[model samples]
Target: MKAYILQKDSQSLDNLCLIERPDPVPGPGQLLVRMRAASINYRDQAIVTGGYFGGRVKRDTIPLSDGAGEVVAVGPGVSRFKVGDRVAGTFFLGWVDGPPVGRRTARGAPADGVLAELVVLDEIDAVALPPHLSFEEGACLPCAGLTAWHAVVEACRVRPGDTVLIQGTGGVSLFALQFARASGARVIGISSSDEKLERARRLGLETGINYRRTPEWGDEVQKLTGGRGVDHVIEVGGAGTLARSMQALAFGGRIALIGVLSGHQGDTNPHPLVMKGGSMHGVVVGNRAMFERMNRAIEINGIRPVIDRVFPFAEARAAYEYQQSGALFGKVVIAI
Candidate 1:
């Protein structure tokens, strides 16, 4: 089996090495997955540079939380999956249903991830891929897809006539655009690049705001909605954009805080949220149940994840580089 492991010394791509290892085997309630594809996320870059939640890697680790493949074997007591089933791993290892509890370990950083030819997953920690999706598309669902679903569908309960404001044209934002559009919501997106904004419009974005051109885009959003503001804001840009998000939020609107792409520190006031009677929910990637529900939605809506590029398995490091290059409009995948 071939796997890429990030060494503990440098905590950068310089330390990421591809090596041969014995094929992983399934244990009790586990499934042996033959990984066909994996996707890079912003967090993967954070983890590689020692910027993730738990800081630097404590040991050599397989990096990446999102992957999809076929189940080649199932261990004793495993009932959720069978051989030949296509599946994707959940971001949080133990979050199968309900509220998250206990120590949460996500792949590609603290835990061994699916950036290998073969990997082991708890049956409870995996969900069957939607039938219509290929492995490369399915590989995207575990992180970005589920986070968008959790925000737009579960947290905001987006419905027809609702207005959704997504921060960028990145993976999660694009998925949120699709989900909100599927739910009959009008989607508005903001990006620094006009070309990306144009692409998002083609993806059902009702309006596009180039934040660079319209630095006070929140005010622009309110104007677009005739001063009513938006029902939901997919707030991915941490402190740098939270104040503007609050400004764009409608009365009783909900903002799902999913990332801190723009520096984590700032003096954003929360008084506007109180004034607007709005709520902000901090969304982790999501539970397995959420992943399953999102998959069902993907299947019914015929939604396909947007992939910006697919690199060969040997160029996994290049995939990571591309993700950080800021040229991505969607996901960067590794065809394992």
Candidate 2:
């Protein structure tokens, strides 16, 4: 099996080399998957750069948590799937249900991940991809799609006629917009690029705010809502945008703090949250149960994940570089 390995003291993409390793066999209750596709998440970049979750990596590590493939073999006690079943593994290997508790429950960290020709996972840790989706599309679901679904549908519980704000046109934001639209919510997408905003409008985004042009985007959002702020905000900007997100919320509005794409540190006033009776919820990528529920919604609604680019498995480093370039509007995939 060919795999990308991240070694200690390697901070550059050049360090991620494709190497041959013995194919792994499925352990008890697990299945061996012949990977067809894998998608890169922002977290994968952090891991490769030695900054994910403040953890250290000593051994060469396979990087990406999201992948789709066909089951090649099954271990003892594995019954949920059989050979030739197409499936994608959940990012969080041990978390099958409920809310995330501690740091140990995290996924896509230093652990050997799915950026390989083959990988093994527990039967319950994998879910069937939507029949209508391609392997590339299925590869986009496990991390970004599941996080967006959990934020808008499960955690925020966005209702019809409710207004939601999504920052940027990254994978999670685009998925959030699609899921919010499917749930009958009015979506307002914030981006710095007018071109990307136009693209978002075609994807059912009802309103688009070019944050670069209008620095006071929170005010623009308020104006768009006729003085009533949005019901929910998918706060991907982290501390840099948190203050404005606070200003853009209606009374009792909920903000799902999902990422810190902007500088990790920024100042935010607590008075607005208290005065407006709103709450901010920290959202890590979700669990296996959430991924399954999200897949059900995706199948029911016939939702398609937006893919920005597909790189060949040999160009995994190039794919990561592209993701870091920030020129893409949606998920970046590696076809294995």
Candidate 3:
């Protein structure tokens, strides 16, 4: 089997080496997944640069939380999945049906990632991929996709005729836009590029705000909602945008804090949260139960994920570089 290992001694892309390794067999309650594809997330970048967990890794780690594969073999007591089933690994393997314990349960870093030709996953941590999607598309779902589902469906519980404000056209934001739309909610997107906004408009984005032009998008969001504010704000910009996100929410609306793209240090006034009584949910992807339910919805609605590009397995480094560019419209995939 072949796998990419992030060398414990280095933190750059140069440390990510693709090498041959002995094929792994499943243990009790495990399934050996013959990985077909994987996708990159911003967190993966942090892992590659060695900045994710304070830039110090005590041991080598596999890197990537999203992957899809075929079940080639099953270990004893693994009846949940069978050989030949198409499945995707869950982001949080240990957090099966309940709330996550912490980042310790996540795949790809503290745990072995799926950026390899083979992976061993607990049967309970793998979900059957929707029949409507391809391996590459399924590979994009575990992290970015599931996080979006958690924000829209679980945290906010957005309903039809409700308004959702998604920040930027990244993987999570695009998925949130699609999921919200599928639930009959109106979506407003904010991005720095007009070109990206135009692209978002084609994907049923009800309103697009060029944040570079209008720095105070929160005010514009209120104006768009007729001073009532939006029902939900997918806050992916971290502390830098938290203030505006709070300002953009309706009195009883909510914000799902999911990312730190815009830096993690800033001071936000606590007044809006106290006055509006809006909810703030710190989403950490989701549990296996949520993943299963989200797949059912995807299957029923025929929701095809928006994949921006697919790179060959050998070019995984290039794929990661592209994701870091922040210019892509959606998810970047690596087909194994």
With candidate 3 superimposed using the best TM-score fit, by how many Å does residue 198's alpha carbon deviate from the native? 1.3
Clashes of each: 1, 0, 0
Clashing pairs in 1: 64-108
For model 1 the local lDDT of residue 316 reads 89
lDDT of each residue in 149-267, candidate 2, tens digit only: 98998889999999999999999999999999999999998998999999999999999999989989999999999999999999999888999999999999999989988867766
Better of 1 and 3 by lDDT: 1
Choose the strongest candidate by lDDT. Answer: 1
lDDT tens digits by residue: candidate 3, 1-336: 999888885578998889899999999999999999999998898888777855645578778889999999999998898999999999986778777765546788778899999999998889999998999999989999999999999989999999999999999999999999998999998998999999999999989999999999999999999999998999999988999998899998899999998886788897897899888999989998999999999999898888999999899899999998878889999999
lDDT of 1 by residue, 1-336 (tens): 999998884467998899999988799999999999999999988888898878899998988999999999999999988999999999988888887676798888788999999999998889999999999999999999999999999988999999999998889999999999999999999999999999998889989999999999999999999999999999999999999999999999999998898988899999999999999998888898888889999999999999999999999888999998989999999999
CA lDDT of 214 in candidate 1? 99
lDDT of 2 at 272: 93
Candidate 1: residue 280 lDDT (0-100): 95
* Cα lDDT computed for each candidate against the true fold: 0.92, 0.89, 0.91
Which parts of model 3 are misplaced by more than 4 Å?
none
State, as a TM-score between 0 and 1, how close model 3 is to the true structure: 0.97
- Per-candidate TM equals 0.98, 0.97, 0.97
